[model samples]
Target: MPEHDDAKADAKATGAVTPQGSGRASKRPARSAPAFGAFVRKEPVRAPVRENTQANTPVGASTAQADGLRVETAQSWPADAVEVGAVIEAYGLKGALKIAPHAQGGKALLAARRWWLLKGREQPERHSAVRASAKVHGDSIVGQLAGLTDRDTALLLRGARVYVSRADFPAPEADEYYWVDLIGLDVANEAGVELGKVADLIDNGAQSVLRIEYPETGKDGKPTTGERLIPFVGVFVKTVDLAAKRIVVDWEADY
Candidate 1:
């Protein structure tokens, strides 16, 4: 061993080249990915949730454990979901959500059991919701969402837009129509004189008013640059046919 050491030292001292490549085993530990089921936290549901409430907690395992409850991190939003309202804030400590309705009467907001909550104006149908116990709370509506049992989670959903499928709308009463059904319907007067088309509806404290836009110039060659706010009272609006895409009113085109 001494003679071998001496020989190695002599070889190094003589500037002899050593071999580079060899059969050396690597000692590093192999890397691995986490299992899919390890993600869920077993937090107890805070409230006595309704049996119909079905929401997933983003985690995969908890979804399967919840049985009848739904679990989804992503979804393909339905095409028929009509935008109606938005979430402003969480109502109280019990996980209720406060909503700002798009329409004045909020008939479309109150009509549906399912809602699609989009984080922004972009992709809204991806994460829809199953809602319950919706009612008017001052100027806004307050409601409950499944899996949102805590106030913190509700607060996080401050700017989420609300959309409800037209398929789930409550059947309209005889002679009554939803505000969405009235939009874009052409308006004409008693003498069959075409007034204009329904541009939009404005809500006063007492009732809703229809805003009509004229096609041709009235007295001004550049069209009526005035706001035609016609009251949608029982006396003014005579007939509304969504299928026919027309509305007959007791209004005058000149006036």
Candidate 2:
């Protein structure tokens, strides 16, 4: 969710936070958080995109436009980059892009000054500096990427996923955490009974819930697996030790 100046090590932790692996972060004192905001949860919604008449264009244009919005290609990707949202389509005539931020409401995107746009998982990513960006329609964001002018170029960016370096994200308030920071941490009960690792989080309109998966021995003494859903409330989640890579809760394994 945030970072300090330990440069290289922080970069590795950024890439490791993706779904396939886990990352370790320094521990912070556990405190009672009464409310949560952008770091908590945001549901995805369809953005209202305006149609444009410009034709398709490629990302490798060499010339800079008169207004100084240059389409410069990045030579390398930032190690701290993390996917945040995707461009839906062109909005208006002056190169504005309609974006559908990920489940977290583009909190990181809103805070970032630059963005990396990827066409696909295998393709190389391109970089764009932000000229202006704002949240629109409650769940979506409309942004103007520097050097990207005209509706045609904006159309070419449709479906391009947007990424921002984790270091660029704003720090969460005490007792609050970004969902990305909680995923993959081990969860256990007060009595130290292993429950599972956090696989994902769910927003049930009222609050966030932890989705944990773990292995167990069935009544027949055979190995089995099960999922547990625990509300991420202070009453249940007692302590979160990111340095120790575990969470202590009041929940029971059977529950």
Candidate 3:
């Protein structure tokens, strides 16, 4: 995973932002994300699987029709849905798509059976049941949607952003955590001095780094801004309690 260089202005500080497949759980120093996608689920919140009914047609079936397509809006999206990648182009003579996965890579996409696609920011979003998906060379993904069978149809989907439900994401291993889960957790040193909340994380070849944002106080006792880039290794990150939304580290705020 590449580092998120830009600070997220709208980073969810507190909420049920469980980890999806894009990021791996942080445990020890030098702990790398698995070759496949890594995601974690906070039990009891299963991904919603709405069956097709007369009152409500399946999302894909309805979106196929021009009239149904107009009804799509942000409100129709699943609460757990997270953008994972985008369709860059059509692949092969057969109906297949080339995907440019977000920083987390295609692990979550590979594990998902269905995918949501959006053409543009304000455009309606639609779901496509996946028939097959595979990781390919160049850190990309090649996938086949159930109803698509020709290159022409696949080309039409180019530039569409892909999203997967967090509920559908597979669980992480012991001591592992999803990146989403750590984003808003509070950070404190061993002495109990408040540092800041996690702003984001980035992969620095060997390990993930936590970008923390705290407040800097001036000589007059006015609060300013402070940022810290701490390595997420076990050496620095002593303990992580997701339920408590707190992380105890070995470093001090001034350092």
lDDT of each: 0.55, 0.64, 0.60
Backbone Cα, N, C clashes tallied per candidate: 1, 1, 2
Segments of candidate 2 deviating more than 4 angstroms: 1-58, 61-75, 122-125, 217-224
Candidate 2 scores a C-alpha RMSD against the true structure in Å of 9.7
Deviating ranges (above 4 Å) for candidate 3: 1-72, 217-223
Q: Write the per-residue lDDT of candidate 2 for residues 1-255, one digit (tens) a residue.
A: 121223224322221111211111237454443333224434344435546433234454442343334444455667777777788777889877777777534556666778777764565536456646554444466777766677766776777778778788867555556777788999999898999999887776655778999988899999987899987776567778778889888788766
Query: Which pairs, if any, clash in model 3?
Result: 25-177, 37-107
Supply the global lDDT for candidate 2. Answer: 0.64
Q: Using Cα atoms with residue i matched to residue i, what is each candidate's TM-score against the true structure?
A: 0.63, 0.71, 0.68
- Candidate 3, residue 109: the lDDT equals 69
Question: Which predicted model would earn the best lDDT?
Answer: 2
| Candidate 1 structure quality by residue, lDDT tens digits, 146-179 | 5556665565456667777878765554444556
- RMSD (Cα, Å) for all candidates, in order, is 31.2, 9.7, 12.2
